[model samples]
Structure formats: C-alpha cells, structure tokens
Target: MKKKFPIIETDRLILREVLKEDSADMFLYLSDKEVMKHMGLEPFQTQKETLDEIGWYQTIFKEATGIRWGITHKENGRVIGSCGFFNTHPEHSRAEIGYELSKEYWGKGIASEALEAIIHYGFQHFQLERVEALVEPANSASLKLLEKNGFKQEGLLRHYEFTCGKFDDLYIYSILKGDVVTT
Candidate 1:
C-alpha cells in the first residue's frame, strides 16, 4: 500500500510535500552550482526548469516510487531543501534516502532533525526494514550525519555514478529496523 504524505514537524523545521509554489525557492538552491555539487543534477537554468523538476517529483509520489518533502524552516517560513526516500523495493522492504540542503542552512542540525522524522516514518508507516544512503566519498559532513544517526558504513562502490563530467565513487551506508533505537 502507498503511504500517505504526512506533515512532519520538528522543533525547527517542517517536512511536507513539494508543491508548485515551492519551485521558486527550490530554484534558489537547485540553480546554485555550489549547493548541487554532489547531486548529479545540473543547475536549473530557469524557474520553469525547477517547476519541471517538481513535476517529476509529483510523478514519483503518484507512482509510489518515492516521496520527497520540502524542508521548510518554521521560524522564517522558507523552504530550504528536500529530503526523502527513493529506490524503494517493497518486496525487499528497503529504500534509499537522499537529501540536499541550501548552502545557508548547512551545519545547523536541520538536516538531522528532518531526517530523523523521515526515518521514523519509513520504519513505522512504510514498514521499511532497511534504509540506505549513498554519499560521495569526499562529503565528510554528510558521512558524519549518517553515522551520527546510526547508519553504518557498508562499503565503497568504485566509479558508482557518473556525475560532474566524470565517474564518482560513492559510499553506501545503511541502518536496519533492528538497529534503530527510538528515543
């Protein structure tokens, strides 16, 4: 069964489904090369491009392939980034998690807060037995974030994905249902 999109609120953030109105804010980061460094996506050339990307996200949800939420700052009411699970295999009870934040929101624990909520949702609502993350080798900040959340470093995949005009190595990290401890 497809899990419904639910609004998740943390102390400092709100995680909700992406909307057409979010395209402008999404373009703020999606168009910035520095913010999309590791993601295989090119900077959006225009707001329409961002809207098109949102359409793709809508398809992902409708197809039950994945779900992504716009991470909005509650205090300022600004969308800062996106986080979600994709590559879901219902038969295997597994999914891959991904997230990207605006440059200005980095190092503020916002990602951690949003991810914690989503991970809990994956396990409780979606019945996900395992959640995975694929991160670039050089992204220490992201690596630390996953590790701090109980995701263990699984292995390194050499030349795993082609991005930025070359093949890039990625590190796989995962946390199983048994491994998570609820607070």
Candidate 2:
C-alpha cells in the first residue's frame, strides 16, 4: 500500500497533504496581507510565487525528513490552511513544526486541531523525541494554540528571522514524546 497521511477529522476539519490542485486556494489565503503578516511572507504579487510555493509542497514527498499537511473544512471541502513539521535534526530526533490559516478561518479552533494531529503523527511514525515550533512573539493566537496542545514555551531567539523588512524574534515552544498530554 502507498504511504498515507494520518488524515485526521475533528468535527469541522480534515488535515492532509498539500496537493497540486490546492494552488488557487493556497494563493488566495497567501495573498491576503493580514493573513500573511505573522507568517513570514510579503504577499505574493505574482501568480508564479504562489505556484512555486504549491510546487514546493508537491515535491515534499520526495524527502524522508519533512512533511506538510493541508487543513480543509469537512463541511464545505475548502482548504483553509496547512500545518506540518520540517527541518528535522536526525541525530536528535527532533524537528520544527509550523502552521498557517486563512483569515476567514481565524479565531476558530482549526489551527489547534491541525497541529495536534500533526504532532501525534510525527511521534507515531518517526523516531522523534521532540517537536519544536518557533512562533513570532506577536502571534498570540499561535502561542495559545501550542500551549493548549501540550507545548511549553522555551524562550525567545532574538532576531531569528528578517521578514517583511524587520527583524523578528521567534518564541520557541517544544513538546516532547510522552509529555503529560502530548502523547
């Protein structure tokens, strides 16, 4: 059988891999300035930039270390966002997790659902000992989501990323295997 994503369903959403057909939907959300703010991106003014991102997702399966998941609504079947882990440190059996949701889907619990599912999948399928998420300090919602999902705030990495013309500090959070509530 072909390898399959966990394909989690939590009442309102389904989390799965990003597909070629999802380009337009991904572009729509990625192009929104407000949605793209915290996410490290200067809105895609050209369709090619959007296509490149989708293409990058499509090529993800060729790797053994990283995986990405698309978040779609179960009721309308629209892809509202994505979540996944990447930049794995094989020796330490750890990786960084990241996520982004469309503006329309904000304030809902979709981001948390997608994150929990992906974290579970990582431990279930990989030899991972821990998963880390680096969030911009200003993204309060993201900080809350990681906390609710059993991650603990580690500290800030000053000047972690230079995005949209300014240096941003990344607030690091980590969830280890079998953490009180993570497993």
Candidate 3:
C-alpha cells in the first residue's frame, strides 16, 4: 500500500490533499476564462466538470504516484489554488508539477510559498530524483516563479500543449535532487 502524504504548511498557506468539498473553491479558479488563457485549459463550464476532477483526485491519491495538494490560505482558510506533483514516475523517481490560482489572489507570493512547501514535501517523502514544471511562455509570471524557486529552464518544446483552444510551446523547467541538496 502507498503511504499517505503528509500535509505541508507554509507561513501563509496550507498545502493539503484535495478533497471533494473543494470543488466550489476550485471552480473559483477553473471557471475564470482569463486564468486559463495562457494555461491551455478551457474554462470549466459546470460543476460536473469539477466533480469529475474530484473523482480523478481519488484515483490519484490511491496510486500515490502523483500527490495532489489544494492550496488554502492560512489566514482565511479558503482554497485559492491547487499545486502538486503529478504524472509521477515512481520507478524513475521523478514527477511533473502544475499549479493554478484564482486571479483574485495572484501577485501575493502565495503560489511561490505553496510551491516551495510541496516541492520540499516531494523531496523529503518521495525521495524524488527530480521535479519538473512546464509553463506557457506567455505566462511570464509563472515562468518567473519557477525560475525564482530554483528551477532552471531546460528548453522550449514546440506545440507542447493544446490549451485554451490553441497549440502552444511549453517552457520546461526542472530542479534535480542533487541540485536541491547543494543549493
């Protein structure tokens, strides 16, 4: 059986496993057309879509391969974003991570804090060999955040994702276990 992942906390946010109760909170970000603009994700039109996502999370947790975290504000106790390592390769000991936050909460460093906490958890508990992140080039803030958090830009993949009704290049960024230990 897979071990349960512990919840991670930062000064301003609590990164915990996503629960079905979080659908409404998640909709706050997923519903915003602009939030998904550069992300290649289309705006989720209904609650059922949110429920479907929740169902997927259940499978995700069971596999214990890709640990998912819902980002909630420490002060308000509101779920404002989701950030976690997904597409896990346990044998390879690596994972790809992704995150999305409500526009209302952008620019406050919450994403950065949450990301650091999750990355730390991935390393400490999973013995992750490496963690990778892919961001759309147009989303400068995300790209910048990854860079700020010690992820080095590995390369740009042509038409890496089909998001928001368009095919776009994705900038790959990564930090290895060895790099984390040294830095």
The lDDT, on a scale of 0 to 1, for candidate 3 is 0.83
lDDT of 2: 0.82
Give one digit per residue, the lDDT tens place, for model 3 in 71-168: 88988787888888789998999999988899999999988888888887788888898999988888999988998899999899999777656789
**Candidates ranked, most accurate by lDDT first:** 1, 3, 2
- Provide the overall lDDT of each model, using Cα atoms, as 2-decimal numbers: 0.90, 0.82, 0.83
For residue 54, model 1's alpha carbon misses the true position, in angstroms, by 0.9
The TM-score that candidate 2 achieves is: 0.90
Instruction: List candidate 3 stretches off by more than 4 Å.
Output: 1-5, 181-183
Candidate 2: residue pairs that collide: none
- Candidates 1 and 2, the one with greater lDDT: 1
Q: Which candidate ranks first by TM-score, i.e. highest?
A: 1
Error of 1 at 150 (Å): 0.9
Cα displacement (Å) at residue 79, model 1: 1.1
Candidate 1 off by > 4 Å: 1-4
Report the C-alpha lDDT of model 2 over 1-183, residue by residue, as the tens digit: 556655767777888777777878888888888888888889888778877886666566556567777899998787888888788887999999988999888888888777877787788777788999999988888888899999999999999999888999999999998784444
Candidate 2 runs further than 4 Å off = 1-6, 180-183
